[model samples]
Target: MSDSLFLGIDSGATTSKIAAVRDDGSVFPSELLQRPTGSEGGPEGVIRAWMRAIDEYMAEHGIKWSQIAGVGLAVPGPRRSYGVLDSGPNLPDSFNGWNVEQDLISALKQASGRMLPLALGNDGNMGGVAEAHHAIGDQRAGVVMLAPGSGLGGAYIDPTGMCLDGDHLAGMEVGHMAAPLHLLDVPALTCGCGRTWGCFEMYTALAGLPDLLNLALPRYPDHVLADPSLGKKERVLKLRGLAQDGDALALELFDLQAKAMGLLVGQLAMAVDPACFVIGGGLIDPDATTEAFRSRYLGGIESAALAYLWPTQRETLRIVPASLGEQSQAIGAAHVARLTVKAGSSVQPFSSTSR
Candidate 1:
């Protein structure tokens, strides 16, 4: 392990996750915590949860404030700058008004009794970079990570394997890009950002699953999933279980998700042309109830892309599952803290002295 350690915070709509990570992206699973976030109480709810998680993890791992170098935060929206969040649709009302850097700096120092340099970045950007760094490393000339939950998020890596956070509005807004008009045969589902129908995010995430289910239900009237008591969550669980067994309704819904997702993936292949695309979030996990189901699900995504790949070859951009699983974002944020601080002494240099 390196002499320095860093803290990474991933503040999501429903949960806030935290961990202590090394510069090399290594993390001890024992030194992690997850808690509900700033939904009801606003920013204070978020800060309290974040601090409590940090305190509990540091205590359990015997890590001290002096050994920590800096803190990195991953907020789930576009950053106005390094430390400011421009929009937070999923977050509580206070998040929209609070100054992330100033508020976090004051609260974090109060928690640890020392001032640590804070670094901030978009959640999608960090998640993509983390997956690229771990999944492809130096082997790939380029990679892009697409997260398809809550809302779509994307990150790109150059040939040298370093993730790129492009200047405001140019890159990373891939989610906001319009989906093909043909895909919107169902009722229009507007995004929280107030975008109209046909947005890439509307058909790809769990949020979009309800809309997909409504469309699929009409066609699968004879299927067992049509039971009204099943609800969205239960219906999803049952369908995935059945899909693993080649059930028609289950397979068709997944196929629909892939077909919609492939539109965006296909578009990315033309513009960014990454060697591989890592897909993450709750929708797809290669590890499943059965090996056959996992293969079928992944295969569904690949085969569906053929329709949209157009000028580019169908196999151009490979798709893969997230290697680091849920920990990828937090680990990425810590790496950002580690890298940024190492780049400049004036940066929030973590204490290197051994306890």
Candidate 2:
């Protein structure tokens, strides 16, 4: 038994996942770990809690920490240059100045009594890397991954096998980009960060959709309060059901979401004509292939690209849902860990600060 098992962990707002893989990219369920992430406690507590979960999994498998080659952690926030997390709204403010990347490596080394290099990056970046490696296989050139869920996250990989970790480690912060608001007539909605209108989270995110639905609620009061499955799916299924039931309001909501997403795609296409646009998240239904995210969003962008900071090119864009679904980031973390260790380097965690 080689003690070269690679590990990857995904730290999200609601839940955290850890996975282990062999050097050949073969993953084993016996090596995977899942647990809740206590985001409210802030970054340090969350990391500690997750570390406990990982410890439990390792113990159950009778696997010593020393057996691990390296660990890769994908965090929900941006990467910091000096091992710190710049900002994460869902986390407590105590996480400020937390150097997530360095801290994890230190903890692992301390626990194992061995220096296991840790690799870190933004959750989105690792998700893109993971999805591309899993889905596209060897083609690493220019690929874009769009995550549409609680918030929007975008990751871009260039032709030279270089992942965009940024100079300050804040690469691919597209969720912060100002996506359009096709449904809102009001002055642009502000983000929790207190920015003015047109923020990305305010447009297509899970948080944004309910507010958008509320705007249409007055017209279709029946569905707002009466739908049995309303709150569970964040009213997404309700909106879709209503659309199916000929509720004008629901149809309007879906149409609005589609249009806004389309516009976003168009804008993204101009910046990098990605080989494939991998869409992943809770909202994207893998079964709903006919939705044509690229066509719809690119169409919107084609109409509105001139107004954009960067013009778009629609001819070469292909929009597709990520095949890995919710597990992309975790899988990618494993891949990254294995690659880093094989290269004879320590893995870089997302940040050095606790948050």
Candidate 3:
């Protein structure tokens, strides 16, 4: 393996992505390729799919296993630490109560024919690393990232562009944090974490949007989503479409949710006081017609976040969209691989035997 090349892999429930990153944080032209995650295929199926994709990516780019200095894998988490993924809301149930770390390491060794140093970490934490080190430039600053997808996730990066949660391995599970009690009802939205009501995700996260709408349906009898026949996907899509079209109900939801988000961000700011906040995920990546609505949503948060801040604190805080687009996780995984190999052992070891 070329010493300059590092391999990074991100395995999500629906897709598996791989990338080759250089030591200086730049990725190869053939940076990313995606493959099916094979969630229903069982463990063997998932492992084989990852192996095939990795092998193909390496061969297509003439990258040898020998040239690779390290390998990093980012997966969904909430285990004791990296490599110990007992279960995640995003992954298949088959992965729960299994030895994900060792199994993946052994499988990777068998597939690649090498015992390269490996680092495994939470995808959200790695995404923070990518955002800190690669995205938004090389400057060292305190950056907080909020990815609103299936659920909300957060990662904090210190001024040196290093992950703030590295000491713990798994990044902060911000979505599970409680929301304002006043905004919650007894039968509030059901969150992915299995909690009903009060979770910050109830008002955010694409997956949680439908549940939020379900609660709001009763208040707007004439709203399209009020129809009992609409499924979750239909409810969410209709809401999104209406919001994009400047529908009053949808716009009001954004305006109202902004206050809740402002409270959360304000609370976080009171604790960490980060330099900037970067927001991302499919929720923010609207197409041409929806750009205006996207701006409104972001604007709402920006304005609301200031509610709790004084003039001085609000003056310096900045929030923006992800500059790296969808490649943040892949690139961050490679960077973690490079850093792990350099350190000889990761602070969050992928295998229990590592220390």
RMSD to the hidden true structure, all candidates: 5.2, 5.2, 3.2
Worst 10 residues of 1 by lDDT: 346-355
Q: Give the TM-score of candidate 1.
A: 0.80
Q: Give the TM-score of candidate 3.
A: 0.86
- Candidate 2 Cα outliers beyond 4 Å, as residue runs: 1-3, 29-32, 38-48, 59-67, 78-82, 159-162, 180-187, 217-237, 244-246, 286-316, 342-355
Clashing pairs in 1: 69-350
Give the Å shift of residue 280 in candidate 2: 1.4
Q: Which stretches of candidate 1 lie over 4 Å from their true place?
A: 28-31, 36-45, 78-82, 85-90, 109-115, 138-140, 158-166, 181-193, 227-237, 286-289, 306-317, 345-355
lDDT (C-alpha, whole model) for all candidates? 0.71, 0.66, 0.72
TM-score of 2: 0.75
Model 1 CA lDDT for position 55: 84
Candidate ranking under lDDT, highest first, comes to 3, 1, 2
| Candidate achieving higher lDDT, 1 or 3 | 3
| Candidate 3 worst ten-residue window by lDDT | 181-190
Best model per lDDT = 3
Per model, state how many residue pairs clash. 1, 26, 4
**What are the per-residue Cα lDDT tens digits for candidate 2 across 24-71?**
666656644678887777666777877897898788877776678778
